[model samples]
Target: MEAESGKHIQKAEGTKLEQSSFEPSALSFQLKIGFDGKRAANNLTGLGNYSRSLIEHLAHQFPENQYLVYSPKVKSSKQIDAFFKLKNIELKLPLNGRFLWRSLNILKDLSRDEVKIYHGLSHEIPFAIQHTRIKSVVTIHDLIFLRFPRYFKYIDRKLYLLKSRYACKHANKIIAISEKTKADIVEFYKIDPDKIQVIYQSCDDSFKMPFNKETLSRIRATYKLPEKYILNVGTIEERKNLKLIVQALKEVNEAYKLVVIGKQTKYFKTVEKEIEKLGLKNRILFLKNIPFSDLPGIYQMASVFAYPSFYEGFGIPIIEALYSNVPVVAATGSCLEEAGGPDSLYVSPTDSTGLAAAINQILSSEQQQARMKKKGLEFVQKFNNPLVTQQLMDSYKALLNTANY
Candidate 1:
């Protein structure tokens, strides 16, 4: 790959001019970014996925910017095919190292390399090194436990709020993943709106419908997915409201099977038991730990993509479903309203009957389904990575101008 001329890269003559250039060679300023690698090593859930994807994008977009991804385990097999694009971005995985050591010693390491900024991709900044002179920015994905504490178990909920409070109080700038989350931060933490920047997360471009017949057939056989199944992607949890979806699927026409693609948790035994009682053994299929590459085929082959989660900072799979031109049925709560709009077939998350009726209506009406395919394609356009990535780059420019970072 030819190195993009730092001067001409931004001046390329295309609508998606921003994406054409990926140059890490002319790095003018160094950035040392720390992550919750200890937490990341355990389970890569919402915040972990958010941290990994955005940092990958940043590393690609500003190749000239020295990118150091500081993780707890310095060495391990956490290779992301998504990051195959950012070959130059250094991964400083300090595996088996104490979290305290990385949190405290990271800045000194950055200083030795003369790195200008230290960004914490997670909410918890280094509490031990807050007063350091290095420029700092923290990404607060969401204050979920702060707003919906009851959704979390006691001990996990307690620790999150306390750590978030400290990070918000001290970090030079805060990156809020959604506008709804920024509002929560402003209200709960009482931070200035100016201090909090809304950086919408982008759907990984790999989640597009693939054309390879051999690959599609292999994935289909492996998952045992029907050619015409309703798809739901995301972890099985209470907030995901999988129980209602399972219940609603029972009422849908017997021809349309329900296929769920994600990991099931112990708390979601309620959903698992409901599936058993309903005798949906053949009607419903659950494929956990589905590979990222295979997901686009899952979305493309679905009769309709349903996500009835009660809350979200931003719904990535909704956008993924839309891009695949799969008709979407998203919940009418929280960020879904902002994320899906008319592109999705919407119903209140509160009413299971309402959800069931909507599903029946979509499944029954071919005309309505046709309209949704077009609407979803239109809705997904705004979420195209080049646009969102440029917005993120603008945020980086703003942070640079802030004089604080």
Candidate 2:
């Protein structure tokens, strides 16, 4: 009796499949989404943060979509670039060794395996994969290489410009983190404006809530933070405009120290030398690679968070600072205004005096700080988890509509 019932169910399912116009995939799924996992589970920066958040969001939101993470392969065409190394790389990711192996060789396998959508989490797309069945989508974080080439090495800038130009030209769709970035891509690459979509980046979930006083004290002790210090946290690269931030600190009262949280690259020494020249050695502290968990407390302890970077795709740190209720004095131009919205005190990135004056105003006026704190929280509220995740899903759906997934 059981054998007869099983045969009946099988016969019915076969009939349905025969009648239906769409057939189930030869594999378990219809679509495959690929991410450039070059930085995943290793040292987490803005790109890593963006990658990790989006991966988790995608996995949770659309469980049916089969996702493939494309990382670098170890053996072929590998040049160990020291500039990419961070101390935390070994702490978590076991797949770090296999990365170069995948990027060089296994990318070709995507076509063999029938991947439908390939998304470059960073600006780069594997040049070898263009002939494959996979449709490419590239996210252009910024055109800073074109806009501020002087801040980068000549060769590095040229390489980024070339690669990004190719990616923009070839990809099926382009994702821009801000409107300013989309505009820059259009002007520089001369791509069709209709091909790009402006999607804002969301702050990390860890920054959403406040930190405890004990944790703040521990972070202060661990980093040896100065009493009553101001904070600036991001990469200590030249494009961050640290020279002006250091110069601006000179005009403020001696009670406040300018605390920077990021590592030093070669070009960053220019800012360090200026700090010494201005007799600010004792007043400015550089702390690199703080754990992300502790940054919220560090931000909370900050009298104000001053970020006067000349360029950005979208200022995630500004959103993080605001979420922690830290008053912000961020630069006005580019996407800083978009990220900080109306809540931040926008100073011209090149004007040290403007930055200093803005800081002084925020520091001296308690009412202004209070108002900014309130407004900052409110500003960040719109950029919460659901909205950003939903926006990205909508973009993916739109791309599918335009192209065969």
Candidate 3:
């Protein structure tokens, strides 16, 4: 699967000029790079993890370059604290009118900082970036609101479309987290496929590290986790399809329970009703506000990881589960196959029986579990920190090396 996806990624990148090997020392001078740091400082989920992980790895791999993280305000946490500890990274905050500064006024600061390249870690870049000397890049994580319009409010969809379309039209480069997202960008916004690059995301180092049995046991007791259970990690929402798992639990063995860890939305109430309808109130566990430090341990201790989300740009938890050495079973119809690789099991998002069978197959056979764990870990190394960071840096270098820039 790694080789197969590599061919697709290589083809996606073939449109770019100067497809040369990238080495930090080959450059004659240092570069100044800036990022839209809103999610890195404030968001703790998908976008935030993407921002922090990319910035951290870039700074580590190329310490000669300076990374400027610009945001309106920052919320302090252990993750943010560790991020600031990197010597090459500096955080920039607005003077006043926080929203206005990030949108329209930030170009003035970029000129003063001599930022050679500015990357929007989420779905937006500052307005009027094209008029300035800075080369801009924006990562469109997913078009979920556009793809599943029923899940979002009318006004929110309008706002998202406005910002995303403007960014796609104006930015020098567009980064899509998965090929699925890249295809969506071209289809929905009518952008040229050559203008976009598909770069996969990597999970945090915490998930890749080994934990002692005592640590795993402590986390198990802390969460009161079942001895054998299927783990699902993500927000509890309709698109996440938690209820499908609830319905599948009826077919799974009674000895195995379902553990969920995420924030709840109104859709959670609907899931609770399904649990009641199926008499699974006691068989399911919903955990919220779990600390980041304990998540890897929780993943390592689970019997199997299940993600039946109807759609996603790329499923980070699937890779996180793979890194934790847990077998993964995720829903089809999106980029999950790319994330989980070929060895991992996949089922239709709406097929509860198939999901149950896949879950039970792993739980019942130790040999099957071992084979998946080995192949999954080997396949996921393609998204390791060095490789992913270098791919991103190559994009930046390509933009800077362009004749127009």
Question: Which candidate number maximizes TM-score?
Answer: 3
The digit string of per-residue lDDT tens for model 2 on 275-305 reads: 8899999998888767666878888889999
Q: How would you encode candidate 1's per-residue C-alpha lDDT over 217-283 as one tens digit per residue?
A: 8888988888678889998878888888888887788898999888778757898789899988788
Candidate ranking under TM-score, highest first, comes to 3, 1, 2
Q: Is 1 or 2 the stronger prediction by lDDT? A: 2
* lDDT by residue for model 3 (78-99), tens: 5665665555667777645566
Identify the leading candidate in terms of lDDT. 3
- Candidate 3 yields a Cα-based lDDT of 0.87
List candidate 1 segments past 4 Å from native: 1-48, 81-87, 93-99, 128-130
Q: Relative to the unseen true structure, what is the Cα RMSD of model 1?
A: 6.2
Worst 10 residues of 1 by lDDT: 1-10
Stretches of model 3 off by over 4 angstroms after superposition: 1-29
